[model samples]
Target: MSDPFTFQMLVNYLIIGAGLMALGTLGFLSRRNMIVMFLSAEMMLQGTALTLVAFGRYHGNWTGQIFTIVILTVAACEASIALALILILFNRKSSLDVTLWNEIREPGQPAIVEDPAEAEATEPVPGVESYPVLTPAGIEPEHQTWTVHRD
Candidate 1:
């Protein structure tokens, strides 16, 4: 209900909002865990909402309140979807490190490892075939020896 030009009010709002933003950014950047990353993203969203509310209060406008509510709803949806995705990824890989996802390549194709050292190699038995051949439905096949060639 007043002009948005008070020095003390502005400083207070900036301090709170910017502090939240800084914490969110730090978490997002420094944390390797996917859960923490998602939480940090939500923190950023909360900081943005806080800034909006502060501006709305200072300018005596209802639009900022409406926007803040919208942001909250969007944040909820994002959290739900992100959590679901995290669960699925964890189930598949059993780890939340972004580095584990390096197998994901562009164009939706499985990434190829070039060097033998970089590849996950399996120990082979002396007289046994290394690769097993799998046939289509209702078909049985023989096993074979195969060497993977990498770039």
Candidate 2:
């Protein structure tokens, strides 16, 4: 049998779980991409699961593991539904940007609009290409034209 979890181990697990939750929250709130936001939400769920497992192990009970399993089931279902919704939304908007779906906001809430001037004022980073440069490899093959007789 494995040695029981020490107090320090429990504390470490809790700290790591909390960190994951914090990062997930930040990503969810700051990112505009639907996929990224979904991943962030998943991260948060995983963090909670981790914490639950740690607690359950520490207490020598099956409750935490059971809860984690239940959470995993719910998360799987949520992922499928969320993916379908994202596909439909992408089809409608031709983009995964969350801001494009302002119409779906609460009825009484005002739409948030970004200032065009501020957007235009932002400058690109100096001495950095927006895309990666791939080195060319090998020589190009020679092409030959062929004439075919009609059947």
Candidate 3:
């Protein structure tokens, strides 16, 4: 039996997948948060899935679909690992800002620092707020005298 979808439809699917991958790459390059990076990675995977599905449909075989299922499984595993890594990183610094981990570099390499002027000029994306900082409590209380012996 002849396939229901036209060649043009397959091309469209491929184009859409390419677009998704591009968008994900741009997002990955621009974002600093680990969560955002993971989301971008998922977007790229989604794009790949779309392309694979299109190929499977065009070839009249289950190969593409099977590959997509594998991709989904891998993506799930990747997401879980990423979540755990993010949680550990956040616990260490108590902040999701990736710059906190800049010290993780080659032994002899100097740390990379963002220029202050650029940092000041580039405002965070709208609606993206830094998490609130907990207020510092007062200093340790003094218990200078234990008068039990005298009493």
Model 1 worst lDDT window (10 residues): 142-151
Residue 69 CA displacement from its true place in model 1, Å: 0.3
Give the per-residue lDDT of model 1 (tens digit) for 1-151. Answer: 3454576886688689888999999999887789999999999888888888878877777987899999999998998999999988877767676556766557887764435386557688656476675766865676652432223
User: What overall lDDT, based on C-alpha atoms, would model 2 receive against the true structure?
Assistant: 0.89
Deviation in Å, model 1, residue 8 alpha carbon: 2.0
How many clashing residue pairs appear in each of the predictions shown? 0, 0, 0
Listing every candidate in turn, what is its Cα RMSD in Å to the true structure after a full C-alpha superposition? Answer: 11.9, 10.9, 9.6
Candidate 3 off by > 4 Å: 1-3, 107-110, 115-151
Residue 31 deviation, candidate 3, in Å?
Answer: 0.5
Candidates sorted by lDDT, best first:
2, 3, 1
Better of 1 and 3 by lDDT: 3
Give Cα-based local distance difference scores for all models: 0.80, 0.89, 0.86
